[model samples]
Target: MSSPEKDEIVVQGIAASQGIAYGQIFLFVRSEVEIPTYQVDPAKRIDEVARFDRALVMTRQQIARIKAEVEKNIGPEEAAIFDAHLMVLEDQALIGETIRAFESTGNNIETCFNLVSQRYIKAFSEIDDEYLRERAGDLRDVTQRVLQNLLGQTENALNRLADQRIVVSHEISPSDSATLDRSATLAIVTDSGSKTSHAVIVARSMKVPAVVGVRNLTQRVKSGDWAIVDGYDGIVILNPTESTLFRYGKVQERKKSFESRLLEANREPAITKDGVSVTLMANIEKADEVGIVKNFFAQGVGLFRTEFLFMNAARMPSEQEQFVAYKSAAAALAPQPVIIRTLDIGGDKPLSLQADLFPKEDNPFMGFRAIRFCLEHQDIFKDQLRAILMASAHGKVRIMYPMISGSEEMARANAVLAECMTELKQRGQPFDENIEVGAMIEIPSAAATIDLLAPDCAFFSIGTNDLIQYLLAIDRVNDRIAHLYEPTHPAVLRTLQHIVEEAHKHGIPVSVCGEMAGDPVFSPLLLGLGVDALSMSPAWIPSVKYLVRAMTMAEARALAAEALTLGSPKEIYARCDAFYRARVKMD
Candidate 1:
């Protein structure tokens, strides 16, 4: 791993919680923040205000250019996420709020910016919706620039770190994640979030290794501490020896080779050696994701995160608007089944109008969220259901309820759905009654009651992330207790096994859309548990799909049986690795 050092050999602390990635360095300095100033020189103040506004316009143009260039350089969908980020650049609420704070208080630009950005960011962070939570980061990134510009600084006047710096921060704010150019960023090191946070999402989207929630990341790794980040296991190493570097260098190469092959895997079908075909689908959020699905040749959109529709809308979105969104998705995927989850917004999703929806609770995890809200508020629930039913007429749509407890809850939910259908029929509104209805087996109670629920629903989507959380009583997002939240745990595996078997016994298909579904090591285990389909991130499609084709039904079953007999989570992981590596080559 030791090579001849150039003039400035840039070595950084890698937050390799995602894995090691080797690519050309792309350096990016965040746009300067604009501070609001009031000099009382009305003429001069107005002119400067105009100038600041003009500069803001130019900054927006620059963001648009970067977005298009990144999209053109990479892929459209990758760029589209940034493009969506750019939308906040032109947002009126953000702009008004930032400037208003300065106008109202005589606070300097930094104070105003600190106040305004923090206010909105806190609000966004409190939102339960995953997609909307990202917007807070977007706003933070832009607002920082606005404040910097207002302070009359041309650049972020922090200490000079490196020509190619991997940011080692206490926490990677969404703003930091958005503004960093992946080409310049060696990797990201932070002390916050599990795999589902903005840091992990950005790293994965950019194919960079990000280690988040390291207790003392900034303090432990000094300036220019030669470090290595293992994103695969969320490990950050400082001042690694030559031996470790050499090992990581090879690991990086092997990882690259494997990823390249997964891209090529899309061209081939997921067929077993004996020729059994497995359906592979991508879980998507934005409407633009449909293109990625087509590009990857995905069988269909397995999970369409409908939460995007509810984000940024005033009040409830009309049934027609919801219908159009679902219809467009259904028509885009055409014969392929679109499992439309009915607004999985709760806990952290920020709904501007629904302050009452998010009641103060001791535990937000077990609080009034998901289907509980639907049961309490029929109008909103019916609005979403009506939209789904209408979309069903356009193409195959499967309606899914999140956080189902038992048959009674599901039956009550369906009762409303039936009323919606009846109303549609009475109005001569065309919709598909054959649209499948299902529940998310994320709650442990739901897993226990799967037998009672199977006969009432069309299918079951086992959301492993939450199931593991509820089963083990550990929050995946909390760093302190995340170690306890292992998906391969005996209790968790048994739950997955029971639900999958119960669903199959009643001739119902059970699919998994959680993180475990995307893991190559767990694919065989899932199939062994009798999972019919796996819906994961669009990027993971080819790898998991390829894995599906390599193992046989008998092999999968044997692996599953062995996993059941395992006593420890570590043993389960070892067994999964050995089982898959023995046959599939782990690309």
Candidate 2:
């Protein structure tokens, strides 16, 4: 009997990467490994432990090979995805837990390791932050690889693909994504994933279309089935009709043309039609990403998240190590301001190497995180400050603190900076004593008291991501209430206006460095509200720059004025969207 005929199906998911692809589905499934469990005799326990050690060595070598290949095929930034994998391998806490489990229970090494790793995976997966929650996938990937190596199983399904096809899976791990053949893989589709997942990072780096979080997509489609992957709008069409294909071909052409126009406009300065210049900057995680910053024609670095330096390492980076990293970015973008945000760890971004430092909290976001964590751990905070000071000697460098609730927190942070400066001076270190310091206005108290906080700070950067979340009291990652976390809400808009007005009163310029800042739709509204600069991911700069160049400041202000009068978020957003669409011709 033949397989039953299936009708066309359309599935919606999160758009992980932009582009379009139409090809036969290659359902790449890796079944869960069946581990053999057996009791280990006391004498043979040592031998079992030794066997486990060798398996770790083998897993390390395999990951190293994959990392090297990824570095060669893609760029270093994308290859940095594997850095987390290597960190997992070297994690003493995880390794020690596995050993303890085996010694206590006398179970096989595989069972002990599996139990420990699964516990960790569960913890990370339950995290409230999307970026951190995706890390669970990293743990899952490494665990499976180690288990397979111990069982002497070699599965390289992705590498063995003989033809180009749309790769679909339940969840594509970082290791599996790194090994993907760019020439043979048409696009990547997953039943579960997010834009922040390592696999999605690889897909974006490869410029391959990817649609993720399509619930039960793997079960819906099978191998050899035809599908249209619309990564732009996060729609996947199975068994697309000839008419649908024709329509999409034209849509693809239009999208490519629009992207080209955005790039072309990016090469020019971000000046409005009325000759008002806007400072467009990039938010970077690592020093190596300075190349991308310049490539996107950004004026400078707005938010250099220093927590990545800690999160990626097996231990806290020394002052000298951090100095080198900060200096590289400063020097690379010399003459351009590099605003380094001090360690914003805790909550979603936990340091596995120093796990004991942070205790579990019911609500880590508003709990002992960011400025609170730094103030209590003054030693760690001072080291980062000194490094930023040293890097300032090389090029333009400024410091910004995250989650400052009010002036008292700002004063405490500044007092520590003063201590670092005094120590640097005593050591005969040449540094920028007049280096500017800024505070992130994310907390409601900080925003409410901007007038009080502005006097102590040189600048202010509105962290709209957190600000909106706190202002609306909605968990952004929660799908059910995420819609309630609206930036266009009257309260959010009014608060932003108040911040800008107050910051300007004290002669301090304010910039927005959040998801909203990068969006072209919101850029004009922010500028109209008197924001001095916009900082966002480098890739998004082109489109935002294009929008800035397209309209006049007067028009932006008029749009903002109209939006402020609107009663509901839907109405306000509609007005903003119309303003953007009117200025930028998409059709």
How much is 359 displaced in model 1, in angstroms?
A: 2.1
RMSD, candidate 1, Å: 5.0
Q: What's each prediction's TM-score?
A: 0.81, 0.96
lDDT for each of the candidates? Answer: 0.71, 0.90
Candidate 1's residue-wise lDDT over 205-229, tens digit each?
7777776657655554455445666
| Clashes found in each candidate (C-alpha, N, C closer than 3 A) | 35, 0
Can you give the lDDT of residue 559 in candidate 1? 90
Sliding window of 10 residues with minimal summed lDDT for model 1: 1-10
Worst 10 residues of 2 by lDDT: 1-10
Model 2 segments beyond 4 Å from truth?
Answer: 1-6, 126-129
